[model samples]
Target chain A: MTESTLETSGRDGLDEQAGGQRNSAAPPRSSRGHRFTSYDVEAFEVPGGREEDWRFTPMKRLRGLHDGSASATGSLRVEVDGSSAAKVETVGRDDERLGTGGAPADRVAAQSWNSFTEATVVTIPKETRAADPVTVTVHGPGRDSTAYGHLQVRAEPMSEATVVLDYRGSGVIGDNVEMIAEESARLSVITIHDFEGDATQVSSEHAHLGKDAVFRHFAVTLGGDLVRVNTKVTFADRGGDAEILGVYFTDGGQHQEHRLLMDHAQPNCRSNVTYKGALQGDSARSVWIGDVLIQAAAEGTDTFELNRNLVLTEGARADSVPNLEIETGEIAGAGHASAIGRFDDEQLFYLQARGIPYDQARRLVVRGFFGEILQKITIDEVRERLEAAIDEELAAVGV
Target chain B: MATLEIKDLHAEVETEEGSKEILTGVNLTVSSGETHAFMGPNGSGKSTLAYAIAGHPKYNVTSGSVLLDGEEVLEMSVDERARAGLFLAMQYPVEVPGVSMSNFLRSAATATRGEAPQIRHWVKEVKQAMGNLEIDESFSERSVNEGFSGGEKKRHEILQLDLLDPKFAILDETDSGLDVDALRVVSDGINRYRESGDKGVLLITHYTRILKHIKPDYVHVFVGGQVVESGGPELADELEESGYVRFANKKEATVQS
Candidate 1:
C-alpha cells in the first residue's frame, strides 16, 4: 500500500532502556500513587506534575488532556488490511470484549474511552498462523484538530501472528490500545508512530498474557512535538512471558516520555522490558519510568527492566527512573537498571582526529548508539523505515 | 620538507586545587625524515606536549606557538590539525561504542583525503594495513578500541599511523603497554612509515627499549616539563644506563638556586 492512502491513528509514538545502574539501592521508582484505573473520566483528577507518576512530565505540554477542555472535534481514520489473514471487526462501545484487555488507568485514557465513538478489534483464531503481518494503519484528523481513538488485538489459543499498528499524519490526540495473548499463543505487536511535526499524542497501552503465552511489543517513535506513552503488562497465569522493547528519537523542542509497568501477579512468570531513546537539539527531552511490582503470592518470578537514554547535544536532557518493589523474597531474579549518558567527548575527539568533520563524526556516533536496538527489529521494512527516519533527523540538524 | 616547530610553548591542565602548569617554556623543531625521541620520567609532561600540539581540549596553551611549516598549528581544531597532516598516537586510545573500525577509518580517510576513498581500493588498503600490523581481520568489524587488550590497542594505533600517512606524527607513550613481541611489531610498522622519508616523527617514551628498534636520530632529555638537553642517538644509550635521575636533580638544583 502507498504511504498516502492508508488510514492510521495519530498514535504519537514514544519509547525508552537502561544499563549498569545503582548496584546498592533497590529500584527507587518510588510509588507515589497506585496505578488507578476506571472507565469514568471523572474518577481521575487533573495531574499537577508533583504526582510521582507525573513528576518528570511537563503538564503544560499535555494540551488539555489533563484538564477536560480538549474534546474531539474530528474522528480518527483506521484501516485494517484485507480479511484473508485474520478477523477484523469495527465494534461499538457496547461490545462485551471491548475493554477485556485493560481499563483506562489515567485521565487521558479514561477521557479517550469516554469520547471515542467506536473501537476496532482484530483477532487471530486458534491453530492458525497469520502468513503476512496484519497491518492496521491509523491516520489523524489533521494537525489543526483534536481526536480520540481505541484499538484491541487478540491472539487466540495455539496461534501465532504479528501485528503492525502504524500511526501516521498529524493531530492533537489521546488513545487507548489493548492487547491479549491466550494460552500457548505467540503474539508480536510492532507499533510505529511517524507523525507530522506539529502533532501531540497521549496514549495508554495495556497487554494481558495467559498461561504459557509469549507476547512481544515493540514501540517506535520518530516524530511528534509531544508524545507521552504509558504501557503496562500483566500476567494471568504461570509460564507467561512478555518482552517489551522500544526505541525513540526526540528532535529539538520536543518532549517524549515512556512509563512502563510489569506486574508479576502469577507464579513462574517471566518478563523483560528494555527501552532506548536518543535526544538532540535545544530543549529536546526524553524521560523513562520503569516500575516492576512482585506481589507476595508471586513466586519464582523472573523480571528485569532497563531504560537507557543518550543525550546527543548540549541543550538536550534525559531522565530515567527505575522502581522495583518486591513483596516476597522467595523468587527468581528481579532487578532494574536506569542510566542517562551524554555523548562521549573522547569518542567524538577520536573520530574527529581521524579527519572526519564535526558533523559527520556526530552522525557516525549516533548511528552506532542506536545500532544495538535497530538490529533487534528483524522486520526488514520496519528497520529500513526507522533507519531512514533517523537519517532524516540527523540531516535536519546538519549533524 | 615540512617542519613542525615549537617556539617557547607553555601549557597547563586543570586540577582539583586550581590550574597547574605542565609544559613550561619549551622549544624544538622537527623536519620530515628525522626521528626525535623524547626520553623522560613519569609525570615529566612528555605526553602533555603531545596533547597540546594535537589541540586536545583539556590542555590550555598559555603562551608560545606551534607552527606546521610556518602556519599556526595551535589555532587549528583537533580534526583540522589532522587534516593538516598531524597525528597523535594516544597512550590511552578511548573506546568508542557502536562504530566499527572499518567505518571510522573510512570516514577519517574521507575527511583527510577530501573525498571518500574508492571503496574497492579502500578495502584492499585496509586489509593490507591490518595484515602488516598483525591485527586479526575480525578487529576491523568490531567497535573502535572496545574490549581491546593493551597490546592490541597499541598495534591498532600504529595501524592508523600507517594508513592515515600524516606529515608529522606524535607518539605519546605508544610503547608503554606492549609486550616485547607486540613492541617489535609496532616498531616495525613505524619504521615502515619512515621508509617513505617524508614524515617527521616525535617518538615519546620513558625507556630506551623502543629506541633500539625505531632508531631516533636526535634524543632530547625531558625533565621538569622542559627539554634540558638535546644530543645525538648516543644520548639514548647514556640515559638507558644512567636513567633520568641526573637530569631531574639538575632541574631541582636550578630551581633552588
Candidate 2:
C-alpha cells in the first residue's frame, strides 16, 4: 500500500488538486514524496492562476504568497492556555514532531512552512482526558504587512481533548495547521476566522488519524477581504472517522473559498463533510470543492459529502462541486451532493400567507439555513457566538 | 359580526396564451355565523375564486372588489389581508424546511394579533387544538408541513383556523385527500370554530362527503367561473345524486350559442 506500488500499478500517483491550471503540454513530473510527505517550498512552482488548484483563487489577492515575495514583516501574538494534562512547547523547524501530520501540498503552504520562525506544539498526555479545552489565540496588530504561522496539535493515545484556534485583527497572513490523533483518541478542532475588512488569509490545514481515532473539525468564516482555506485528511490506520463541518457568510466584495480532500488510505475508515454558506450584495462570491479519494487497499470505506449554498441577493454567486474518486469497487459506500440556489419562492409565499412580513420571513429562512449546521457544534458558548454572528450578518444585509 | 361580500368579481390569470379570465362577474355574500358551500367540478374556477379572495399575486382582479366588513380587501397585500381577518386553507400546503411549526404558528399569531401571545397560554392553546385534531405531540417540533401526510396537512390547516380565529376562512378543497376518519376530525374542528357564533366559513369542495358532517346553510352550483344555481342544503343532496352534468351542459350550450 505504499505510494510507489500504488503508482507502479498503472494508476497515476498524482492526486487531483483543485484550483490548479492544467498544463498538459509539459512532461509528466516524477512522483513527489508520499502524498502527505512533501514539504520543500521549492518543489511547487509559483502559480499563475492557471493551475487546477489555484484557478478559482484570486492570485493577486494572495499578497504575493504564491510567488514567495510576501515576507514576514508584521508580527502576530500567539498565546495558548493548556491544562495540567497537556504539554505546550514552541519548537524550531527541525523539531521531530514538526511534520507528522502532513506536508505542504501547494505553493502557499510550502511558503508558510519555510517562512515560520517557530511552531507551537500542543500535546495531550496518553490516556488523559482534559476537562478544559486548549485555546490558542492569534491576534494581528492591524499592520500593513505579511506574516506566517504554524501550529501543531497532537492528541495522544486514548486521550480526549478539544482545541480552539481563534484568529482576529488585520493584515495579510499565511498559516499552516497540522493535527494528529493517535490510537483510540478523540480530538475536536474549532477554527474561527474573524478578520478585519482589509485582511487577507491563505491557510492550509492537514490532519492524520491513527487506529480507531475520531477527529472533528469545525470552521466558521465570517470576515475578510479574501480568504482561502485548503484542508486535507489522511488515515494512518484502520477504523478512523473524520467529520468536517463549515459555515460561512460573505458580504459585498468578499471572496471566500474552501477546498477539502479526504484520503482514505487505510481499511474500514469513514468520513463525512457538510458545509453551508450564504452570500449577499454585489460581487459577493463563495466556492466549495469537496474531494474524496478511496484507494484500492482502503476497503470498507464509508464516506459522504454535501455542500449547500444560499444566495440572499442579486449579483452574488456561489459555486459548489463534489468529487469522489474510488480505486476499488469493493468499498462499502460512497456518495456526494452539492447545490447552489437562491431562496425558495414557494417558501416565501407560504410564510407571507401566514401573516409574516417579507423581511421577517427572509430572516427566519436565513436563520434556519445556518442553524441546521450551527446546532451540530458541541460547544454551547461557541455555538451561541456563531449564531449571534450570523444574526449580525443578516442585519448588515438589511434582512 | 363580520361579512365578506364579493361583488361583480372578475379575475384572470397569466397563462402562456396571455391573460385568461377565470372568474366572470361572480357575486356572493356571506355574513357572520353562516356556512356557504361552493360546489363545482374540476377546473371550474372554484379554487381560483378562493385564491383571488386571498390576494394571491397569480390571480389578477381585472374589475371587481372583495369587501371585508366594508374594507376593500383587493387594495391590501397578502399579509395585510391576513392581518385584516382573512384566512385561506390552501389546497396544497407548502413545506418550509427548518422552520418549526411552533415558531411559524407563533409568528403568525403575533402578526395577526398585533402582539406576541403569552407563552403559557399559547402552549395550552396549541395543545388543545392539536388534541382535537388528533395530531401527535411530536408535530410541534417538526418543520411546518415538512414530511407531513395529506391528512396531517389538512388537520394542521384546521388547527391554524382554530387558533387564528379569523372572521372568515376560505377552505379550498380541504376535503380532497382526506380519508373518512380524517374527514370527520377536520369537519369537527371546523364545526367548533363555527360554534363561536361570529365566524363565517366558505367551504369549497368537489365531493359532498364532507357536507355530511359539517352542514352548509347555503349551496351554490358553480360553473363557467360563476354561480349558476343557489339553494338550501337539499341542493347538495341533489348535486351529489345527479352531479354537475346539467350545469356543465348548460354552460357548453351557452358558449356555443
Q: Which candidate comes out best when scored by DockQ?
A: 1
User: Which candidate's lDDT is highest?
Assistant: 2
Error (Å) of candidate 2 at residue B92 is: 1.1
DockQ, all models = 0.70, 0.66
Tens digit per residue, CA lDDT, model 2, A202-287: 99998989999999999899988999999998898999999999999988889999989898879999999999998888888788
lDDT of 1 by residue, A1-399 (tens): 000011111111121111112122212233311355678777777888896778778888787877898888988999998446699999998989988887777788889988899999999999888878888999988976889999999999988889999988998889999999999999999998888888889999989999999999999988888889998887888899998999999888888888888877789999899898888888887878777767666799998888777777778877777777676777888877777777788888888888888877888888898887788876789889898888888888874
Residues B15-53 of candidate 1 have per-residue lDDT tens digits of 999999999878899999999999899999999999899
Assess every candidate by TM-score. Answer: 0.89, 0.90
Worst 10 residues of 2 chain A by lDDT: A1-10
Where does candidate 1 stray beyond 4 Å? A1-34, A82-84, B15-18, B118-121, B249-257
For each candidate in the order shown, give its overall lDDT on alpha carbons: 0.85, 0.86
Q: Which residue ranges in model 2 land beyond 4 Å of their true spot?
A: A1-37, A82-85, A141-143, B10-12, B15-19, B60-63, B249-257
